[model samples]
Target: MAKGSRADHSARLAAFSAGIRATRGGKSLDINATKLLVAITQADDADRLADELVAKGFRLTRLKTHGGFLRRENAAALIATTEDRLPAALAIIRQTCRARTVTWVPPFPDGIGGIGPAPMEIEVGGAVVFTIPIEGVELLGGDVAESLARTRAAGGAQ
Candidate 1:
């Protein structure tokens, strides 16, 4: 098949699978039992952490964000997993997001008379993780979903 045609066929197949995965017997599918929102302030650590999680068979959705007193670049990783695998996910995050010291300079106000911007060393680069109990999760049209379903069907240990 031509490359374009093959791509088109793949797209259609994915859409069809997504429709099927959305509902089963008119009911939504719930696959995940736990949800983790991990905000990693250190941009440098984001990719490494994400790769490590994927390597460990964990799925993550990354969102680019900027915040904190310094307006630093951040990556927020959304992880959905079973309750039994929550600890493993946390461990990957903890191991990858290491704390380190960074120099920060405070900008002086324009109206200030004599004070100038002062640079100070501060601790930074850590992962802020929040674990929330998810009532349900719906995974649609992807290898991850298929693998998860097969695991559940086989009563695989999480």
Candidate 2:
């Protein structure tokens, strides 16, 4: 019986792997992203990616509050766009993320309340775990071309 069970599990794993490969090679137009632990100082900052995206003539649709990380005030979710624009959107996210940092707050002992004890690290740094094929987005605009153009124009003829 145990040997039979093992064979069954192995078959299931093989089937799952085959399915993933098939999906990748198939012609199903699906664009999605799964970014975890994205730190946005302010909710509005999420739109910072607009300038670059606008230059590309891509429309951004903001999705609902997929969820939040209560412990760290971070967020995880999706923003909709044309399948081809996904890479650009991700690039914007990566650039913005570089300016932000993350720190791990170790829990306090009992009765210490919300305050965390001495944090393990002061500047651990933050990162985004991006997964393709996100559900959708709600708001748009992730380009900064106009701003860049203005800056360039202002500094011209030097």
Q: Which candidate is the best by TM-score?
A: 1
Give the number of the best model, judged by lDDT.
1
Which residue pairs come into collision in candidate 1?
A: none
Q: On a 0 to 1 TM-score scale, where does candidate 1 land against the true structure?
A: 0.68
lDDT of each: 0.66, 0.39
Q: 17, model 2: CA deviation in Å? A: 32
True-structure lDDT of candidate 2: 0.39
Cα RMSDs, all models: 7.1, 20.7
For candidate 2, what is the TM-score? Answer: 0.37
lDDT of 1 by residue, 1-158 (tens): 36456444443323222212233334443343345555554788999999998898776789999988789888898886666778888888888999898999898888779968789999888788887765544554545444444544555433
Model 2 residue 130 distance off true place after TM-score fit, in angstroms:
4.0
